[model samples]
Target: MKDQGRSPRKRTGGRRRPNHKKKKHELGREPTETQVGDQKLKVVDSRGNTQKVRAVTTDVASVADGAETVEATIENVVENPSNPNYARRNIITKGAIVETSEGEARVTSRPGQDGQVNAVLVE
Candidate 1:
């Protein structure tokens, strides 16, 4: 597991040893790289008894075109600001430019965390 705690260093650039072992609450998980394919979802446990729905793979997207929203078939990822390789791998993430049945759109929601792709039509 990855540690989500503070760094083991002082502001004065002095080394500081950890006093305790890693805790459950301070653990982090790997990123969910959502891809375009048949709809697949995974439910994960979150803090405070909440649940998180993650999209593993999906082919649909809700694309908002100003006054109306329509369900569009995702064709492929066009560009990704997060990583250039993500676009090549067809991974979907927020702010990514994707080609849909309606047109090109910019993703407005996190599919990995929201379990669905939401995007806005781009000119």
Candidate 2:
């Protein structure tokens, strides 16, 4: 047979992977998603007040430091969260010490499943 060359993907009968090198994030960051998720500007209701939300948090497997991870001016625990951990019950709300552009938002345990974040609060 002649050389078939490379297929649309490498494997002939396997799952496909996203081309990470071609990703263009809003923050002008190329695929450093493991460390941070995505960034978007939006208006949200915080503490019965409306405020401009600038940054967001991505679901991570492990955090570097708790005291230096979640840093938010306000903290909100998502009840009945989509995350598996919190999805089944009400999670406790506590502020961490992370540094974000929006100030310091708490980075709580995310219910990582189906390759997505189950719940997160932006404030």
Candidate 1 segments whose C-alpha is farther than 4 A from its true place = 1-3, 7-18
What alpha-carbon RMSD in Å does predicted model 2 have with respect to the real structure? Answer: 16.0
**lDDT to native, each model:** 0.94, 0.32
Roughly what TM-score does model 2 have, to 2 decimal places? 0.19
Give one digit per residue, the lDDT tens place, for model 1 in 35-117. 99999999999888899999999999999999999999999999999999999999999999999999999999999998999
What residue pairs clash in candidate 2, if any at all? 69-98, 70-97, 70-98, 71-98, 71-104, 71-105, 72-104, 72-105
TM-scores for every predicted model: 0.86, 0.19
